[model samples]
Target: MMKYLWLGLIFSMAAFRVMAFPAQGGCKLAQQHQITGKVGRAIHNAAQAHVVVRANMLEASLSNAVQAGVLSYQQGHKQWLEVHSVRQQALAYKQGITSHELKQFDHKLDRVTLYLCRH
Candidate 1:
C-alpha cells in the first residue's frame, strides 16, 4: 500500500509539472493581453477627446504600439483606416460624426485587442 501511494504521488507531481509549464506561457500571454488592453483604451480615450491634436497623438502612439509588437499590423491598419474615415467624415460634416459610428469602431478595436492578446 505504501509503495502504491508513492507511485501515485510521483505520477501526480509529474502531471502537475506538465500542467504548470503551460501555465507559465499562459501567464505571459495574459500580460501581453493586458498591455494590448491598455493601448486599446488609450485609442478609445483619444477618439473621445475630440481634438485634432489628440487624434494625431493617437496616430503616433498607435504606430509605436504596432512597431513594438503590442498590436499586429492588420489590427493597426484596420484601426488606422477607421480613425481616418471618421476624421474625414467629421470634416465633411461641420456638425461632426455620430457617437454610434465611433462606438462601432471602438468595439472593433476592443475585439482585436482581445484576440491579439490571446493568440
Candidate 2:
C-alpha cells in the first residue's frame, strides 16, 4: 500500500509539470510579443521625429539662403513651393521625403543655385 501511494504521487507530480509547461510557454510568448510591439512603436516614433526635424531644417536653410542673396527671389520662391509641397505630403503620409532627397536639394541650393544668383 505504501509503494502504491508513492507511485500515485509521483505520477500526479509528473502530470502537473507537463500541464504547467504549456502555460509557461504561453506566458513567455505573450511577453515577447509585447516587447516586440513596444520596440516597433519606438522605431516608428523616432522615424517620424527625424522626418519632422529634417523638413524644418530644410525650410530654414532655404529661407537663410534667400536672405543671404545666395538665391534669386524667383528661384527661392520656386524652391519654397517645392518644399511646401513636400511638407504637405509628409503631413499626410508621415514619411513622404527621405534624407537622401533632402541632401540632394541642399547640395543644389548650396552649389548650383548660389552660383546662378547675382551679387
Q: Estimate each model's TM-score.
A: 0.38, 0.40
Q: Candidate 1, residues 1-119: lDDT per residue as tens digits? A: 99999999888766654443122122243332222212132234333334333334345545654665556788767766665664454344444445675555445444433443343
Clashes of 1: 0
Deviation in Å, model 1, residue 116 alpha carbon: 10
lDDT (C-alpha) at residue 54 in model 1: 30
Error of 2 at 16 (Å): 78
C-alpha lDDT score of every prediction, in listed order:
0.47, 0.45
lDDT: worst 10-residue window of model 1: 32-41
Q: Give stretches of model 2 more than 4 Å off.
A: 1-44, 94-119
Error of 2 at 56 (Å): 1.0
